[model samples]
Target: MLIQLAIIGLLFAVFPLALVLISKEQNKFRKLIAVTLFLTFDLIIFGAFTRLTDSGLGCPDWPGCYGEANPFQAHSEIKAAETLLPTGPVTVAKAWIEMIHRYLAMSVGVLIILQMGIAWWKRKSMRHSPWLPTILFVLVGIQGAFGKWTVTMKLQPIIVTIHLMLALTILGMLVWAWQREATQLVLKLPPLLPRLLPFAFVILVLQIALGGWVSTNYAALACHDYPLCNGEVVPQLDFEHAYTLWRELGRTGSGDFLPFSALITIHWVHRSFAWVVFALLASVAWLSRQQAETKQLGNAIFAVLLMQFMTGVATIYFSWPLAIAVLHNAGAALLVLILSVLNYRVRSSAVPVS
Candidate 1:
């Protein structure tokens, strides 16, 4: 089943590989890295849609939908589940969604393989370090492991969240690669801005984890509206249950209700953290706009932040609409990717060449 799924998945690699194959450009390697990053970004977006829609376990199996490569063979099983519970997590449509996500992931894995191959092939002749692509290959392997764990564990929140983080990490790495490709120096140091950029990156990562936690726990609707949650600015919370890391998928450690306050706490904390995240990122973006090398990047970060802020509100006020929620996740990934580029460029460009 895994082999078949991988074969089916390789279809996605055709276009990008084709571009590298027939391009008239002298430096196909750099273009290949950039294009791979672009496609991987799209995959991360679609993966968000899959998880948000509760399609992670649509197939109820790994590498295949009910021992079949495509959802068609598993139609009977899917129909059985849908008939049993019409709107439950497992259904025909969801099966398709999950399978598509897997297919895209496999395609990306193939591309990464090709990238590493080419990188090693031209190791001595290449201007940039070969370890760049080599490291990407390792990251993709770790990502695949988490992907399997996500399904096998039945979409456990921590596992799923880890998978999400891995995807974003891969995006960060690829963006770094693209920056290296954009310039001749892979080891170039970037300018430091008040020593606050890296500090912001750490905080942003925590915020992202909190947001993912909120999503995985289905706590987004706990507060329902901005500035107030359950009609209180800071309602009574059950942080004990909310922060219990080793609990089951939806229940407390003892298999009880998990506490309503836990949900509120989860939602409220993420909401509060948003204020900090927004203010800090906005500052970083503004400061970046003053520099020539990072100005455009800062502008791009601001644009993504706008999209992030708007989509977040739309998700809440509009009742977690699929399009808006998916866009929110994509915006988060883009924000992370941009910050990574900024971090690398800021450090790389600022280094003194002696």
Candidate 2:
């Protein structure tokens, strides 16, 4: 019952608005993609918030809560469960959060379907490549599968991390498609740094993967302090438990409760590699400053990096407040977008033949 309503609500919320955008916009295709990409990024950030808040299992059911599409519809069930367990995962608030996440996910999927429909209709147009949207359609489909797998598999760390990587991949692809439409083939790169942009993307991808791992593994509080963890020089390590595969989402290989040390391991790795990522982004921004089209993108990346850093510190000092955590997620997604745009601008914007 709740699933049906959520699906209907999502279609109404997303498809109709996109149709309106298609009809009213001068560049309907670009506007549609822009809006979809914006929403996708927002969804990813909210997913992070959902996970951070332990709302991943709030509904404790996939696509619905207690077989209801939305929380409101499942109020009775949620209340019953709350009464029975008292401290269980099926509270009304949690069910609402989880269902809202699902609703947003479905809405984004609807937008992608619209994007693909429009792309197919305009397939014959000489200037646009329909393949980009087509590829995004396929990617979104896979992302949906991962979304289900993430829930059904009990939020397996690997599955959740892969889901995150998929989201970033979708963001990059959309930016690429948008760039292809926005820019003509006349873009030329500065001769000094032809290879830098792609390299920067590679670095960003690695860092983003680590960030996903950190988030999925619940390592955010592994080390509550900055610059050092646990007031120790190196911090007692537990890579075996930290990197154990095929274990429960938050458990260790030996079936013992995951220790703070293991969390510290995950957190430290993310923090340590961040230095390298920061240097790489700094270089990319510096290099882009030398180019005409990417100058603004580079500056934006630099600014977002600073904001991300501040938010990271705030999450620590402020005891992982929800706003800071959500903002950190947003900042991370924006960094991905800025880097993605910079990548698209540098890659697709034609370069002089050597």
lDDT (Cα atoms) of all candidates against the true structure: 0.84, 0.78
TM-score winner:
1
Q: Which digits, one per residue and each the tens of the lDDT, describe model 1 over residues 145-234?
A: 988888888777788888888898888888888777666333322344547788989998998999899988888788788877768888
**Pairs of colliding residues, candidate 2:** 2-68, 2-69, 3-69
lDDT at residue 335 of model 2 (Cα atoms): 83
lDDT of 2 by residue, 110-149 (tens): 7777778888887887377677778888998899898888
RMSD of each: 2.6, 2.4
lDDT for residue 48 in candidate 1, whole number 0-100: 89
**Which candidate gets the maximum lDDT versus the true structure?**
1
Give the C-alpha lDDT of model 1.
Answer: 0.84
User: Which sections of candidate 2 miss by over 4 Å?
Assistant: 1-25, 86-88, 185-192, 350-354
Residue 54 C-alpha lDDT in model 2? 75
